[model samples]
Structures are given as C-alpha cells and as structure tokens.
Target: MSSPDATPGASSAIGSALYQLATRAVRRLPRDLSLTSAATLATLDKTGPRRVTDLAAHEGVTQPAMTVLVRALEESGLVERRGDVSDKRVTLVCLTEDGASYVRARRQAGVEAFQRLIDQLTEDEVRALAAALPALRRLDTLDGQKREGTRP
Candidate 1:
C-alpha cells in the first residue's frame, strides 16, 4: 500500500533528499578505496561471487573497466577470481577475508558517524527517525528486488 502523498513529485523530492544526504555523508568518510571500488566490495560481500560482466552491469561500468578494477583489487589481495563449480569455464569474482574486513570496518565507521549525528537530535526528532526506520529498510529491500530483476 502506498501513502496518499506518494505522488511522482513526492517521490522525486524524497529521492533528491536521500541522494544528497548519502553523497555528502559518504564524501566525509576517510577511505583508501574509491567509491566504486568500495561499492563493488560491498556487493561481493553481500551477494557472494558474481561474474565480471554482472559486476560491470551492476556497477554501470564497461566490461573493460570492471576488468581493470578487478585486476587492481586482485593485486591488493581484496578479491579473487575462481572457476565456477557449476561451469568451470566461467570465472566468478569472490571477496577475500581482507575485503570483508574492510567492508565491515567501513560500515562500522559509517554507523558510528551516523550515531554521533543522531545523538545530537532532539527526543522528538529521534522518535521521528526511529519511526521512519521501517520505511528506510523497505526502501533497501526494494532496491535489492530491483537489482535482482524481481520487481514487478
């Protein structure tokens, strides 16, 4: 069920606000890897191994670009390409233990940063944010569905 005010304009406004907040927050974080690299690592951490072409499509980059990124990651010992068990000819990119650690640390940093900001909010504002948590989680679920091509 949709909210009464869930019109196109409202959706656009929400998207813009969320995008601005996310980009600004991420920009403030200290990181060794580029945003795209971090994102690719996070994806691998979440979904396990995937094909290079799939990663490229998911990341909106060219196959060659993904190949280069994967190469760099491999050199850093962050990811490894292994043959797919079902099909030995296909190689799947899998995240390394170090890569998972990096992802966890980065996520923890982000959580801590948000926690500090959240602590400064008033009781009412905090309550409002808490109330919105379910909706925010649902948005994340929707994004996953879209990515898996399961959305109607």
Candidate 2:
C-alpha cells in the first residue's frame, strides 16, 4: 500500500488514523486521572501557571468544569491555587512538585511504551519513522501555535 504522504486526498485518512492510534495507545495505559486532567497537567508542565479561565479555554472546557477539575487536583495535592503576582484578584493554578513528578513519570511511561512498540517494527519501518520525526515534531509546534492563536 502507498504511504499516506505519497497519495493525494489522503490527509483525512492519515489524520483519522493518527487520532485512532493515539487514543488507543492512551486507553491501553493504566491511569488514575481522566484524559482532561492529564492534558491539563501536561499543559501546565509545558507552559507555566495559568488562570483557571485560561486553562478552561485552552482545554476546550467550560470554566466551571475546569474549576471542578482544578479543585479535584488540589485535593489530590497535585496542584495549588495562588494569587497571581501581577493581578492579585485573579487566581492561578500552579502545578505542585508532586504534579510535576507525576507528569514526568507519565511521559516516561509513554516513551517506554512507544519504544517497545517501535522495537517490534522492521528496520526499514523504524528508519521511516525516524525520518518523519522532524515533521511530526513540527506538527506538534503547529498545534501549539494554533492553541496560542498565533497560527492561521
């Protein structure tokens, strides 16, 4: 079969396939947190502390929903709410040390999982993926840009 990139009109197919693959990988992993929660933590790890409202907007969730989620995380001692230095009236959700550790551990687990799977692929397939890594990383940057409203 022709690679998705080699065929025209295959963008949608590739996108759907990638989405399915990612969701399946995540689902197969054991986790205590909900997907949204994990995503929020990951975002916080990438960026810094953010207002609850900002997090809601970034996560495509309602502010109230994010509030509840943040509360849960706080209860778990994974995150804490603090007054924003520049704006005392606004509260920022900051990841705790525990939260950072959790994020690192989760990411390591994912890397190990993917590494094991990649080991099963043929050498040519592995080479192909290695060659595509740059583009894949660029896609991640584009996603971040889109989220930040810097990309069209």
Candidate 3:
C-alpha cells in the first residue's frame, strides 16, 4: 500500500482530473441549458417539489434569481408551479414529466461519457473504482456539509 505521506501529490492530481472531467462534461451538454438551470432541474428531480424559497436557499441564490430560473424552466414546460395545499399562498415548484425526462437524459449522457473513459482502464482499475464508489459518495456528502458550514 502507498504510504499517506508518499501520496502528497495524489490529492491535487485527483482534484485536477475531476475538474477537467467536469469542465469537459459541462461543455458536452446542450447549449440551450445553462448549468444552473440544469442543476436546478436535477435537484428538483431528485428531491421532489419544494418551495421557491427553499430552492433558493439550497442553490445559494437570491429568491429573485431562483424565480428567474423557475420562470425560464416554466416557459420550457419543464416545471410547474402549484399552490401548496396546506398553505394556498405558497407556491411550490415541481418537475413536469418533460423535466424528469430531460434530467434523466442529461444524466445518462454524463454517465455514458464517464463510462467511455472508464472503459479504457484495466480490469483491476475498474474493480477498484467500483469499490471506491461508496467512499466517493461519502466524500461528496462531506463536501456538501463543508459548503453548508455543517459538521459531516
């Protein structure tokens, strides 16, 4: 096994690789979809309907910014605003079927791109990546916690 001290450059190397991959993947997406909009759709698809204020908080944007995003998405028929049943004054944003399908297609495209790259790896490397997926997911969660200034 590699000693922790001996791997001083490894973290930076991995970070650089991830950044490059993400940049390339984003470039591969449809020009019509801004990254922020795509992210909002993905979040809504994963988390279900939420109040506009809640989405603003989650996305770290002002309410006005989120409202603009929602409006654009609404115009595209990707999202719909529904009056909250419990509180008629509150409007919640939910993904339409089209939105869900769009998000899924985007996700699949990203996965396919990554899979194409991963296919070049050796069998052992692929197995290692498979084994590391859970840890990588945990790391993602930890990163999110750090961003939110919360303990992991």
Candidate 4:
C-alpha cells in the first residue's frame, strides 16, 4: 500500500506543482510587458473586438481596473477604441496591427522557451504531455463556464 503522502489523488500536491510551473513559466517571459497586459492583449487578439465591460468581466477585474489597463494599452498603440456599431455610446477595444505583431512576437518567445525545456524531456514524457494537453484545455473551458454561471 502507498503512504498517504504518496497518493496520486492529492489535490494539494497537484495544485502546488501547477502553481510552481506557472510561476516559472511566467518568469521565462520577455520583460517587455507585464503578465496582466500580455494576457489582455492575447485575449483581445483571440476574441476580436470586445466591450470594456465584457473584457473586464472575462479578465476577472473591475471595470475601473480594466479601464486603467486599456488606457495604458491605447497609449502604447497596442489597442484602439472603436465605436460600437449597434451601440454608438459604447466603445469597443481592438488590437492595432502593431499590437497584434507585438503580441505574436511575445507569444513566440514564450513558446520558444517552453519548447527548449520540452526538448529536454524524453520521448515518452513528451508523449505523456501531448496526451494531457486536451484535458488541460478542458480545464480552461470549465473555468470559463464556471465564471459564466453555467454548470460544467
């Protein structure tokens, strides 16, 4: 029988490992942008133009906080404000061409760093990770669902 500490079902151990890995990965990112800014940029890139309120909700931030972030991004030419066609009073946030390129480059750098680390893993370990990728993606979907007040 395995010791309690050795149990594979230990949630705390899994959470700790996930946190450490995430922290290290973020540290490996380029110094050009803060993680929160990078995250906002990436989200805009992936989801196209969005309302400030919607973006704030998606990012789990208050509207005022997101407004501050959006202002900085706009000042840096990384985002632009456009009038919403259906609602002229509401402004939508979208990435400029330069913003898209910047986000792509930053993302590529992070991918390269991760790829280098993955190269050190054995073929079997790499395959194991590949197998787990789907489940990891599902976790993101599940989290989004939870945030949207939906049952996963």
Candidate 5:
C-alpha cells in the first residue's frame, strides 16, 4: 500500500513516481489558466461564496493579493463580488456561471489529457493503475482528515 503522509517525510518510490507522473501530465497542459485561479474557483464551488479574507486564508495568500486576484477574475467575467445576504457589510466572492464552466472544462481537459497518456501504457500497467485508483482516492480523504486535525 502507498504511504498516506508524504507531507512531512520522505516519500517512497511509489509516491515519487505518482508525483512525477502527475507533475509531468499537468506540465503538458496549456497554460491558459493559472493553478491558483482554477483552485480558487474549485474552492468557491465547493464551499460556496466566501469573504476575501477567508479566501485569502484558504489560499495562503494575503488579503490584498486575493483582492487583486478576485478583481482580475471579476474583470475576466469568471467571478463576481456580491453583498452577503446575512451581513450587508461583508462582501463575498462567488463564481460566475462562466467561472463554473471554466473550472469544469479545465478539469475535463486534464482528465482527457491524462487518459491519453494512460492509453499508451501497456495493458498490465493500466491494470496496475486501475488497482491503485481506490488508494489514490483515499489520499483525498486522508488529506482532508489531516487538515481537520484527524489521523487517517
């Protein structure tokens, strides 16, 4: 089985190989979208509208930086700023319809790109990847658990 916590210590060969593959695959994609922007869209999509301060904290950026990002996104028609219903004083950043579509399209493109790479692999290699899919999915949960201060 693959190790769960590569955040703190050295990763095994399996982890290294997986990381390399993922990095290579991502690097092969078009650079039209920034990772930060795509990730911000995904975060908003998952958690709903949030304050610029909250978003900055989530993204590990400064509030001013996030404001700049939000402004740029707004200008691009990817996201919009809105008054918080519960608190008029607080503004929230939300994904525009176009933003959601961009996130989905980018994600699909990534999957298709990776699938093309997979298609070139030998049958047994593909089977190995298939077998590892469950474990790979578990890493998402494990990372969440870690973020929540729980061991997985």
Candidate 6:
C-alpha cells in the first residue's frame, strides 16, 4: 500500500477526506426540502432570474424536468415566472420573497450543521481545517472564475 505521506497519495487523501465531509454535510441538511427544490432555489439566488432552459442547464436536468420542478416551486409560492424583459417570448424563473427566505434558512441550517460536526473534531483538526480554508477558497474562486470568465 502506498504510504499516506507519499506525494502521489497526498491528493487522493485530501480528495477522500473532502468527499466524506461533503457527504456528511449534505446529510445534515434540512429533511423537508428535496434536493431538487433546494438546488433550484440556490441556482436562482446565485444567478438571478434565468430562462427555464438555463436553469435546467445549471441543474443538469432535462428541460421538461426543470419545467415540472419550477412549476412545483411556483405552486409553493417560492418562485414565479415572468416574461423576460429583453424578449417577451422568453419566460424567466425568479425567486419570490418566500423563496429567498427559504434559501437563507437552508443556508443557515447547513452552517449550523457543519458547526455541529466540527464540534466533534479535535482541536488540532479544527485548526488544520481553519488553516486550509484560504487555499480551499482560493481554489474555489479560481474555479468559479474560469466558469464565469471573470474574476469574482
């Protein structure tokens, strides 16, 4: 077996640890929201209103599936469809005030959940995670920049 300290093993170790943490964090999210709904809210919140096709692209779902999801969110009063200003033929999905509130609540819950998990970590582990934040965030930002084609 490759030693954990070996150069080739380092990235694998980090990736594995991050994957575990991510799965654990996701499990702690509020049970009420289905993954589809939560992700839809997050996408609209982040990118503002978008065409159904755009939302579907971002969520990696079929246009028909996104239509159904958006309809559900609309019925729940979390979102509304409006005519795109630039092109009246285009409809855009926009988050309602209730939707934004739901997003905030979900985000807060996730933070609290992560904190709870962190509480179980050793002090040294906590410090290590804290120290790693900068590099992690930098990498994340770079990734977003590449996708967005602009620095954030």
Reference-based TM-score, model 1: 0.90
**Candidate 5: worst 10 consecutive residues by lDDT?**
1-10
Clashing residue pairs found in predicted model 6 = none
Model 1, span 30-145: residue lDDT tens: 77888889999999999999999999988888999999999999999999999999998999999999989989999998998889999999999999999989989999999888
* Per-residue alpha-carbon lDDT of candidate 3 for residues 118-147, written as tens digits (9 for 90 to 100): 999999999999998997798789877865
User: Which whole-number lDDT from 0 to 100 does residue 82 have in model 3?
Assistant: 97
Superposition error at 36 for model 3 (Å): 0.7
lDDT of 2 by residue, 1-152 (tens): 34656778676786897899799789876679999999999999999999999999999999999999999999999999999889889999999999999999999988998899999999999999999899789778888999877953
lDDT of each: 0.91, 0.91, 0.88, 0.87, 0.83, 0.87
Please provide the root mean square deviation of candidate 4 (C-alpha atoms, Å): 3.9
Error of 1 at 32 (Å): 1.5
Q: What is the TM-score of each candidate against the true structure?
A: 0.90, 0.90, 0.86, 0.83, 0.82, 0.83
lDDT of 4 at 144: 68
Q: How many backbone clashes does candidate 4 have?
A: 0
lDDT of 4 by residue, 1-152 (tens): 23577768656676687789889988878787777778889889988999889888888889998999999999999999999999899899999999999989988887888899999999999999999799779778987687656887
For candidate 5, the TM-score is: 0.82
Q: Kindly give the stretch of ten consecutive residues in candidate 1 with the minimal lDDT sum.
A: 1-10
Error in Å for residue 48 of model 5: 2.2
Candidate 4 accuracy as TM-score: 0.83
Clashes of each: 0, 0, 0, 0, 0, 0
- Deviation (Å) of 58 in candidate 3: 2.0
lDDT of 5 by residue, 33-121 (tens): 67777778888887789999888877778999889889999999999999998899999999999999988887788898888989999
Off by over 4 Å in 3: 1-6, 146-150
Those runs of model 5 whose alpha carbons end farther than 4 Å from true positions after fitting are: 1-11, 145-152
